[model samples]
Target: MTTTVARVDVVAVASPKRRRRAPGWLAVVPLLAFVAVAFGIPALAMLDGAFTVRDQATGATSYSAENLSASLRGAYLTALLGSVKLSAVSAALGALVGLPLAQAVVTSRFRALREAVLTASGVLANFGGVPLAFAFVATLGNAGVLTRHLGLTDKGWDLYSFWGLVIVYLYFLIPLMVLTITPALDGLRTQWREAAQNNGATTVQYWLHVALPVLAPSLLGGLVLLFGSAFAAYATAAAMVGSSIPLVTLQIADALSGNVLVGQENVALALSLDMVLVAGLVMAVYLPLQRRSARWLA
Candidate 1:
């Protein structure tokens, strides 16, 4: 009888525990709903529009790969390639420059100086769009004050061209990379350096093997982030270059605005699909690198 009562009590305790655990999944429901609304629905719409077409005269709807296929050729291809090239260059340069800036900030003795630089970086990283474009144009454009004073226009500096766009992108990308990599730099334990020194490993040797390996994942992830940022940018490029530069984002705008050509809505959708794929690819690499870096830093 005593054993039976003990078992009954155990069963009663387990029931409450199960009931408490049942509602735990409810916390994740809102985030899942948000993802479905924000990303899933738009993705499905893009996929549907990218492959399906409507007849202009007959009003018939049919499914075909023509829109997507078309996005891979001619001007579309040029825009896609140009966007990729720009992203690669900007991302690469941002990582290279930001790494040193971040290191300098991390190693600085002055707390106010470090905080000021970080604060400025946070603001500048988000400071893009037409305002940013116009600011750069005013300072760097062919007839601007700086351009006139510096004689950059005389030296053939064209703000509406590819290289000028690169410089503009770098302004934000470098700061963003600094913000992304600074945490990883801080997570570098002092013990590691002390241990390296105890073993007669010079600072260069210690960083070459110890620091770089640990930082590699974070650096790559930051580069991917910069790439995606530059890839999807539209307003800045639109305000600055218009159709002079054949970026994919600019192509999509032109296609959707109906100012360039007719029947380009499908092309716009196709290009959006391409962007989604590229973003998905970027996330795939970034998430793994982030996880790996977290393991080391945490």
Candidate 2:
């Protein structure tokens, strides 16, 4: 009876469980709004115009594929092809020059020298457009300082021609390639080289079999980036050669400004879409390779 009485005390029941709150997504709202305003709206407008034609006389608009069709034909097509060729050649040359330059910088014993080269490359990569074109003109044009001093014009060197554009493009493209590929070069592990050497590999054999294989993805990614940079470039070419060079960007600008034709603004929009698609394709190829290369670095 005493034990039963002692056990009569009661305990309070536990409160009901509460749900955990989820993380807020409000932080991304500003970025989303900015993209919508700055890029999304303009992109939509371009897409709409690309497939539409307007009559300047009546100010009437209608849906049509004529603009796109026109973009793929005649001079427009030539401009597109020329742009591709220019971009490819510049990117290739940049890779050839920049890979070795990047290797030299990365392997340099002096920290100051490496820092100086990287800093200069960063500045030079962004130093394009009108000012860059002007610099080249002052240094290599018909009456340029170098041209006059070296008598290059007397040798029939034209700074306003296709080769001239390539040289100008290289001014920025090589630096851009260096900036892009430097990280990959640095990521190359010292241990890999030692291992190759221990296995009786020569310098060239080690590079060809091990180092190059590892760096290939990153190298290709950098090349694609350079190509896109050269492809989308407008100001430098415009300032240097104007429409004398048949480039897609120049063609787009001409159409928009009515410098080439009247009432062909839709054609310009179509060309813009085509450029976007090409860039998209480049990114499509690049992103996968970049990811693969990053895995090795990590």
Candidate 3:
């Protein structure tokens, strides 16, 4: 028995085959191709033009920074500053108005009410450009129904002025803020509030100490987004006020279409580059704040 037991042995071996995985890169190819065709090509072309200049006499093309330099001078600078100011004002107004609306929606007891508010916000956020401008003009323009009935024009309320443009911008900007900030409001944990209450903190104190601190990043992110939206806007302002507003976007349109100057196509590209840089800077600040907000939210 001992001899037979000593001669017997068994071993198990693992399989060499591994599980097959679908190629992840393959899934992204379509998106990459679309971006390349739609965004990359245009951006490259603009960049090339931005750094290029054409000789007026010989029609020769050469690389130079004159276009970039030109963009920072005279009316172009004024337009850029005007766009920034408009975006800043609109974003501030939107945040101020939309925050309370978002809070009200989030704290509502009725599910239908919340849904309706969110739905309305979604619609209004995208309800921009020509249609929005037309609506505002119809409602607030000279010979408008309200203006005719209320005699606002008699009080010197011009619908095509800077303040009027701000009012029109607020229509969409507030809704966008509501949409963006609603999630951050919803993410305010019940436990945190309860813990604050348990520590003898009032509602106002809790909001000041705990809720606002957590929400700061999200709020800043939303403001930056709103700024970007207002900065890039063209159709609404164009339709409502034509070239009277003197925004960077309007300037770009003018340059591109030769409405202002015939040989400033390269300047238009440079302006586009400037817009892109500003948007990129906004996102650069936004991304970090967004990440921090996500961490707490998660």
Best by lDDT: 1
- Ranked by TM-score from best down, the candidates are 1, 3, 2
lDDT of each candidate versus the true structure: 0.93, 0.92, 0.92
lDDT of 1: 0.93
Per-residue lDDT of model 3, residues 188-248, tens digit only:
9999999999999999999999999999999999999999999999999999999888899
Per-candidate RMSD, Å = 2.0, 5.5, 4.9
* Clash totals in order: 0, 0, 0
Candidate 2 local distance difference test against the native: 0.92
Write out the backbone clash pairs for model 2: none
Which has the better TM-score: candidate 2, or candidate 3?
A: 3
Ranking of predictions according to lDDT: 1, 3, 2
TM-score of each: 0.92, 0.90, 0.92
